[model samples]
Target: MSDEQDIQARAARGWRLWLVFLLLVLIGLAISGKMLTLNMQEQAFLKRQGDARILRTAVIPAHRGVISDRNGQPLSVSAPVSTVWMNPQEFDLQNASIDRLASLLGSDRAALLSKVSRFRAKQFLYLKRQMTPAQAVQIEALDIPGVYVDREYKRFYPAAEVATHLVGFTNVDGKGQEGVELAFDDWLQGVPGKKLVMRDLLGRTVKHIRELEPMSQGQDLQLSIDLRLQYLAYRELKAAVQAHKADSAAMVVLDAHTGEVLAMVNQPSYNPNDRSNLGAGMESLRNRAVTDTFEPGSTMKPLTVAAALMSGKYQLDSVIDTSPGYIRVKGKTIRDHRNYGELDIGRIITKSSNVGVTKLALSMHEDAVRNTMQNVGLGQVPGTGFPGEQAGVLPYHAKNRLVERATMSYGYGLAVTPLQLAQAYIPFATGGLTRPVSLLKLERPEPATRVMPEAIANQVLRMMETVTQQGGTGRRAAIEGYQVAGKTGTAHKVGSSGYEDDKYVAVFAGVAPVENPEIIAVVMVDNPKGQEYYGGEVAAPVFSRVVGGALRMLNVAPDNWKPATQVVMQ
Candidate 1:
């Protein structure tokens, strides 16, 4: 509009433009300086904030120990497994995602959704535990948010039900639950470790930074059981139980010299691996040999005879009159199977004479029979370290009642576990030395305590030797090529009212190769329902087969081999 005025205005506008450009340059320079300060001075703080979102301290699982039998056979072991978990707070619980996860885990869709929704505030929740690696892979393929997989160990029992009662089982978290597993849990458990790791937004580990603590593995254990003998004993005992239609059964085989349990087994067992039926009942989980107790019955006769001998009132040649087949003590009559006019101590034991043994008890000090029983580990724990081992009832009556003494002398008025009964007979097997029972393998025999005089033990052992000979009660216990010394027992089970006439516990206990004793076995059949319920019929045969096999398996030289008849072909 006006050249001169426009010129002045243009000059002012140019100056204003130049001033604005300079101010813009200063602002840019100031911003660049602040950024440089942050990069060099506050870099560590920013890095820490970034790491808090993606870095994590991850757990390194430790491996559990192996359990083995004395022969180095694995009874229980551990295997690698995967556990799938999720951060419920970060999870997107969409219908599609829930359906897919539930289907993959074999879980109900409604239950899975409700569980996630209920614990939405939780940081960690298990989706499925102890899954296979293949299963974990399928889950990870879903690529769902907040899901994670962790490596862990799951217990696997290789011996299955056969060794379950001895080796026991563990929980999903690798904690021992029963038997030797529970008894030695701490020794078999491992200490887990930790490490610094970086993870992605999807809860997957990207990198391991450094280890915080090293994992400590558990120590292995070896039990005293010989698997071979265990299998043999189990097979034979199971057969006997089923054949007899018995309520239950238990058997134990021990090294007579060392007192180490070679084999221990019970009926109505369960598989530790397949625990689907664990909630059914605890009946099958019991170790009857160590946990159950029964009246020892006539099995107590040998010990009673030993008591009489120890009292210096009876000898190997001593005679007792068992006339009229029975005797009365305080209105309680004790009777023999039949009358045997008069018999020596040896014949008394051979025939298992209740009246003879009762006379022996009536004549000695009242405490004599009870003292002999307690001295040989009765009325006390067997010291086997097994969980739930019972100290069976050995009744003590201070009134010195004749009925009590007479009944107690012939193996009544007291209770004993099958294991305790096995241990009690050890003194007779080892010349009166009572070696401590062991459940763990030993390099050598343990020291023994003298429970009775050596001479008395040998004399009693000789008397027992006749029991397995012709016309003796335990004749069925005799082996083809070995001498056996043992006793038979048949006792009526005590009921709520009185001794039950319908229920009977048949038992047989014996030592083989009697000249130089090697193995001792005890067989007990509870409540046999078959026609024959006596110890000689139901239990002695099992002892014979088991001991006969064991003696041959150990290459023990037979002490009673007879000359084979040579017949010429005519």
Candidate 2:
């Protein structure tokens, strides 16, 4: 602190001053850094809170459409229901929750515990798919935690077993699986929706943020099934199946002018309400009127006779001698049920003699017959705008075995479905024009193809009318009021081993109001094991009752009047 000390002291004092300034600066910097750190922490906390409150989304299911009949009577519909869902992670299987949940859900406690344990990782699981409002209310009263319900859809078929086959049914996922449900699934399914929402810590949807996508409900559909006629057909078919002890029975009724299907039914039917009894036989699933194939028997003879009349080969009154009840065709004998010594074309159809058809078939060229059959909607499935339809079997026109031709002439070689027979008969019903059958009720009329000459059609119609009269093969097929023109067919059903003797396929196909035939009905019973086996005995009587009911219901006045009874004893 003296001279060197004085200079040093001044310097030391200055140095001390500088040290103080540096200390002050350091203190200021520390204070500034602390404030910055505090501010940064506050900003981070504010951002975290905002992130927690932001919403993302939620999904909403769309509603399904309905299916109704022509008159707007619902056949199938979507029913609103509530479903209870559970989140495995949130569900408490122990404590007070277990007993409460078990009682609320009507589940055994042990089973519920086991089932819940299996869904440990699932954020969401269905406790029940469809629950009634009362059930939901009962469940809510239990105050069970971790359980919630959302609105859902379930299919309902009101007609039940009556219209099951054609209407089909939907599956658990609300998707159409079969029948009309499958066929029109594209138009019947709905689009799902998504929503942005804020969820609570407990995973409950709290606040809606933003809707992500749009959703649309499905459109309703209208089908062309006549419920009244359907019931009648079902009754007739079911009665036939029961009376004949038939393995299966089916029927189809077509409007000759419009070609609309008035009635279609099958026996051994199941209710759509319960698929538990149904199997994958594919046979029961089939609409036999439009599916399975079988020998048409003598019902096919009328086509040959029409073809003959059309080609000018024979007249309605033309004479053909049938001797010894049999006719030889290329070394094969074609025999009728009863022998007729001499007969005309009318008697040939009246008696349904195989020999008479064999003679006519021999007289005609094979090409003409083949072309004629094809023209009559044979060798092709009638396009009825439905799936799983069968085309049926048409034999080779020129069979190596001449017996084949004879058999075909008598409907033994050729095979077809009941639907095909109905369509084929349309030509005769509609005065030589063939038309497509419809399952839709529309104001627009269906277009028809010219299948035969009008003259031939009239002549054939006249001859067939005789077949339902006093001594005709289908004598039992006579309805009370209307003049009915039809043919009876009795054929052996072929089994895996061989032809079953007791099993027969009996059928009656014809048109009513014979002068201006309106309805074309084809009734078929398969593998009837009962005593009455002939088409005349089994199928004809069924046809009579069905056609009679149909005519009465339709208010069709009979050209002549009498009940179609076998033995009406008073």
Candidate 3:
């Protein structure tokens, strides 16, 4: 029995030992498997961790598109510049070298310290932007740790103040803020790229790894403006504004056949290259020709005449009595410079008779008159895609009081931008056809829509020609060698009070060479302080000078080279 007990205990001990051995082997296999897995992925994981510390992704800025005139003269261009930035965390703000860094960056020591301390938690901070090559080299030679330079493009307007109103200016970060820059931002801005690079402990790039994306330059944009014409207009408008001591002025010249803006210039212009005055009032920045509205005054008479003619109730020979030279409508008196006893339609335009125009306008239906104004693009944006374009005010049919209707006829109780006024005269220039206005160069001149009968337009054209001839209000607008047709407008400015007798917006709109119209030029001189404040005195001369030069530039042979017949009526 003792021998049996001993054998059983031995057997139990032996089985326990075998089971323990199997468990040990299984544990060893699990350890070996985990070790094998770690062997496979550990190096990659550690490499990634290290790379995260030393490798940096750098941005490569793409160049913005060039803005050019129709003649391919660059209006706005991108100049290469360097921006210095730094990792505030990696930089030692307390280091003595920071003093030199501040000096080179055009920053004081205290300001530099404050900037770095304020952005201590930030990974990146711009030290300076748009540094010249020499400026960049000076900073790089200082070799301050964690400071890095980035390449970017800065916009430079070649025409400066001459074209700044139309080309506009950009922000420090290369964003468009006004004018054409804001209008076509997406088309003008470019796509940025990135690259992975190895950096030292101090955040200085040591070696390039690979490009993550390629930068694509923006497309070039060609404007409908002819730079020569633009300069010409600017020169003339600036001279006029300064000569008259006017508050401000604007001028627009359009290709009569195509409605493409050949030149649009504004006075009191600013230099886009110099941004120190950016915070100034909007008066300096606004493209007043398209953005500002005014009571168009007599520049609106042609449309009124066209509407009267369109009604089939009037002809160029239609006569209206103006014996008193003033007429009362709705208790509001409308007057001309003088009371011409009786005037025909042609003589009315030639004399710029307010009573004559008011009588003619009253004879037509309201809808007919309003439709003519609307069809000529008044009270609506010209669809030039220009930023901040105003749709000038016009009374709705429901609100067309007799007073308002009468006032609208003689260019009151309604407002229009200079561009809109120029667009309105397009029908007269194009023989009753109105072309869509554009800022971008078209593949071809846009198709035209007939706004009035050819005969009516021709008759209006002949009347407008008489305006540049004798007895016309716009005689000053006539070029010596060419017949001109346009109306002079002298609107009493409507202020917080009813109407300021002292303030006026003098305007002239005309199409030159009555036989064959090539361009329409509109000029508006605001609040001329001199004694000569009439449109013929202030604005007409500007139109005459600008359009005359433009016609010669375009090489349009003059039909009135023989000299115009003169008829002077005060």
Candidate number of the best lDDT: 1
lDDT (Cα, tens digit) per residue for candidate 2, span 1-570: 357878877888999999999999999999988878767767788766766655545667787788887678888988877788877887777747667667767887898889889998887888887777678766655555567666678899998877777777888788887677877888888888987777654445668777789888988878766777788788877988887789998888888888887878887788887788788775567667776788889998898787777667888678888889987767766787878878888788999988888888878877556567788888896776666778887867664556777788778867898888888899888889987777667677677789888888888888999999998989999986679899999998888997787778999999998977878999888888787888988888888887788888878777877666698689
Instruction: Give stretches of model 3 more than 4 Å off.
Output: 1-41, 94-96, 397-400, 563-570
Candidates sorted by lDDT, best first: 1, 3, 2
lDDT of each: 0.90, 0.81, 0.88
Writing each residue's lDDT as its tens digit, candidate 1 over 1-570 gives 799999999999999999999999999999999899889998999899999999999999988889999989999888999999999988887735678788879897899889999999999999999999999988888888888999999999987877777778988899988899998999999999999999998888889999999999999999988888888888889999999999999999999999999999999788898888967678989899999999989999999999999999877788999999999887877888999879999999899999999999888887899999999999999987788999998987664688988888778889999999999999998999998889899999888999999999988888888998997999999999998999999999999999999999999988887899988889999999999999999999999998899998889998989989999999
Candidate 1, residue 68: lDDT: 91
Question: lDDT (0-100) at residue 519 of candidate 1?
Answer: 89
Select the stronger candidate by TM-score from 1 and 3.
1
Which has the better TM-score: candidate 2, or candidate 3?
3
Worst 10 residues of 1 by lDDT: 92-101
Clashes of 3: 3
Q: In model 2, what is the error at residue 313, expressed in angstroms?
A: 1.4
Total backbone collisions for each predicted model: 0, 8, 3
- Shift of residue 253 alpha carbon in model 1, Å: 1.0
